[model samples]
Structure formats: C-alpha cells, structure tokens
Target: MPARKIKLSTSSKVFYVICYTVVALMAIICLIPFILLISGSFTSEQFIRFHGYSLLPGEFSTEAYKIIFKTPQRIIRAYGVSIMITVIGTFLGLLLTSMTAYVISRKDFKYRNWFSFFFYFTTLFNGGMVSTYIFYIQYLNLKDSYLALILPMMFNVFYLLIMRTFVSSIPHALIEAAKIDGAGEWRIFFTIILPLLKSGLATIGLFLALGYWNDWYNAMLYLNTETKYPLQYMLYAIQQQTQALASIASQAGIQVQNLPSSSLKLAMAVVATGPIVIVYPFVQKYFVAGITIGSVKG
Candidate 1:
C-alpha cells in the first residue's frame, strides 16, 4: 500500500505562518532603502533639504537626473570601462581557475597533491598590500594601466579551492573508463569531465563578474588618469568634488560649473546600481541552483 501523507498540526501551521510573516517583514526591511533611494533620486534638493528623504516624498523633481544627464560623455565612458573589465575578467578568471583546479583534482596523478599544495600555499601567505603595490606599481610598472585592475585578482585562492573540490567530487570511475578507451588526459577532461562542472562555473563566474563591477579600490590606487577611471571611481570623484576637492579648486581660482550635487549623487548611484539589479534576477536562478549543487558531493 502507498504511504499516507502526514498533515500539519494546528501548532505547526501557526509556526509556518509566523515564519512566512517574519521573512516577508525582513524582505520589506531590505527593500525599503532601495525604494527610498529611488524616491530621493527623483526629488529636488530644495525638497530634500526642507523635508529630508522619506518613504514617500512630499514633492518630486528630476533635478538629480538633469545634473547626471548633463555629463553624458563621462558617464558613458565610465560604463564602458566597467563593462570591459567585468566581461573580460569573468571569462579569463573562470577559465584559468577551472584549468588549475582540473590539474590538481586527479587522484592517481603523481603530482596532484603537490600541485594542490602549491595553490593552497598562496592562501596561507601573500605579499603584504604595500609590497604588492610596490611590485605592481614600481617594479612591474602597471600603475594607471587597465592591467592594474585585472591582473592583481585574476586567480583567487578561495575560488581555486572551491573549483578543485567540485572537480574532485566528479566520479573517478569516469576518468578510468575514459582512459581504458584510449583517451588522453586532455580528451578525458574536455570530453568526459568539464561538462559536469557547469554549476561551479556559473557560481564562480557570477562572483567574479560582481567583483569586477563593484570594485573601486583598484581604480582608486592605480588609476589616477581620468580617462581610464571606472564607473565607481568616476562617481566617486563627482561625489567628492562637492566638498573637499571643490574647496581646493576654488582656492586655486578654478571656476567650476556646479550642478545640483545632492541630486546628482542619487542619479549616479542609480546608474551604477541599475545594471546589476537587472542582471540579478536572470542570474539568480543559476546562482541558487549552482551554489546548492556545487556545495554537495556528486
């Protein structure tokens, strides 16, 4: 006979309802700031200064958008730089990381353990920030260059470990069977193994892309040239100029065409944040499934 399903008790139903309520409340809490930002971005500086930002604004204005739109050239260039970095970095990082992990995942390979050790050793120790900066800036001469942003974080230790674990969990029998069919290591990996690593690839690629998109630190240190500044750094300069730098500029007798700084901040933030927000929903399905699958043993 088929087993009968157990029904939830009244107490269990109440607990479930309470859990859902809590989750909904938490979601609202998280979404509140984003909503406020959108609202504030559309509001005039006069309204914000008089009433302050609230969930619902007393009045609306496109002044922020106006200021932000005024400098179409800089915003477009910043977007271009950020997009190039994100796409190229994600692709290359994923490829190199997966390859390195594959080489270290084989149980029977004589040097597998040693190769794993070499990768892991990097996690335990790294050149200090100062030393690393000096090497890249002074010795390597990568400063103010696009390579400055891409090369430093190309192969992450944690990412390599995750990929290694995922690849290692693939059934060893598959490799052995392929070898019996006269398959070389390259053929076995390309034909028999890599197909199973999709989950790991998606997960790692998403993280790498997000890192490249949101990164301002690299741009700050190495990218002094305005032409090469990424979106975050460009927004940062526009934001900073409202005060400290503007005072210096004023003292230096540089006449600055001041736009509505407060509104422009909101507009810039929206521009910077919009792409990821749109991308997140599409990538989210893969993100959830990939993380769950990659975390468990195959």
Candidate 2:
C-alpha cells in the first residue's frame, strides 16, 4: 500500500517560515563582519577616518597590502615557518595521540585505566605558565628553536580522550580476527585500526594544524631570530610597530607615508586567516562525522 502524504497546518507552516527567516538572518549577520574586513582592507585611511568603514571600500587602495609585501622575503619566510611548523606538528601529534589512544582503547590492556587517568589528569590541572616556560627554556633548552613550538602542542589530552572513545566503539572481533591471522599489534593497528579511525584523525589533524598556524605566543617567548618568527608573530610585531608609529605621528602632527595602519591590520588579519579558512571546507565532512561519532559512548 502507498502511504498518504500529510500536509502541514497553517500554524505549522507559519512557524517553519519564521524559523527559516530567522536562520537566514543569522547567517547574514555572521557573514557581515568578514565582508567588511575584506572590503576595509582595500580602503584608504583618509576615507576610513572621514566616512568610517563600509561594505564597499570607501576609496579603493592597495596600500595596506603593499606595506605587508614591501619586504617580500620576510613575508615569504614567515609563511614558510608557519607551514613547516603546522605540518610537522600535525603529523607528530596525530601519530603519537592515535598510538596512545589505541593502547588505552584495548580491553585486555591491563593498565589501560591507570594510563588513561594519568593522561586525563593533566587536562584537569597543569603546572602554571611560568613553570612551563621555565622548564622549556631552562631545562629543555628549547629557546630560539622550532622544537619549542612543535613539542608543547604535539599531544593534547582532550584529543587523546576523543580518539580513545572513538576507538573503543570499534568491534573487538576485528582485533581478535587479526590476532587469529597471526597479525601483531603494530601490524593490526596500521593495517586495520588506523583505516577505521579516518574521521577522528582528520578532526584531530585539523585542530592540530589550526593550533600551530595560530600560535604566536611560543614564538614570541622562545624565538630570538627574525628568520625563525612564524607568520602570526611576525604579523603581530608588525601591527604593534604600526600602532607605535601611528601614536608618534598623531602626537607630532606629522603624516606618515603609506602607513595605512588600520587597513593594514585588517589586511594582515585576512592574510593570517585565509589559509586555515580554506582548510575547513576540505575537512568539514570528516569533522562532522567525528563529532557525530564522539557524541555518544559505546
């Protein structure tokens, strides 16, 4: 028998229409700021000061972008540093975190609970920033090195827990079948387990990459060489210098040449944010799958 379709009541239809309208409005609101940021980056300082920012640039100028690329070498070097750190950190973090989670997820691992607790404990509490800084600098001797950035963020307790939970949901029969085939733990993990963990790995890798890309604090604290500065820290330093110069120019009642401080800030933000924003769409399917899988326990 064919099922009859049910029609919505007038009130129900009205409610749905209202809901859709509200959601559409909310989406536009979220998009507005980014639109302004892009347009404002091309705007001239005089127009910005005179008329304030607009969705369309008040006066089209590439001055802000020009300032950033004035030293093409520095900008390229910073980008290179950020990319290298992000790739290395993401790869290492995924490898270590997944390996640890695999061990903890095994039902027959005698000390799994103890090890899980040990990792989880760090999430609840940690040595303060001062102590951590001292340890990394004084004891580890990581100052002025790329290792300083890579090591601190290489593994996250929360990520480990998420991976463990996801792995726990996999049928024990798979591991047993591998063992019956004389497959060792390492072989089983690489050939069988890791393939099943794709969504979780993508989610974790995206997070690790974003963390490394956005990191500036570690670089500021540990790196002394200009060549070692990552994109975010270099941008930050440039922003600070621009602000200082603007302050001086304002006090002296002098015009600074081609210093579009406000627009340059917006431009710099666009540059810093663009690459990671592009990454989200590619990982979004796996990200959603990971979240759905992680939402409930086995």
**Cα-based lDDT for every prediction:** 0.79, 0.84
- Each prediction's RMSD to truth: 4.5, 4.2
Query: For residue 289, what is the lDDT in candidate 1?
Result: 58
The residue pairs found clashing in candidate 1 are none
lDDT of 2 by residue, 1-298 (tens): 2332277788878888999999999999998999999999999988998888899997999977776665456668889999999999999999999999999988899999999889888977999899999999999999999999999999988678778876877899999999999999899999999999987888888778888999999999899997899999988886778664464345444566646778878888788788867777887776676566556542
Clashing residue pair totals per candidate (backbone < 3 A) = 0, 0
C-alpha positional error of residue 88 in candidate 2 after TM-score superposition, expressed in Å: 0.7
**TM-score per candidate, chains pooled:** 0.83, 0.85
Q: For model 2, which pairs clash?
A: none
Model 1 ranges with Cα > 4 A deviation: 1-18, 177-184, 243-258, 289-298
Predicted structure 1, TM vs. truth: 0.83
Residue 241 in model 1: shift from native, Å? 1.8
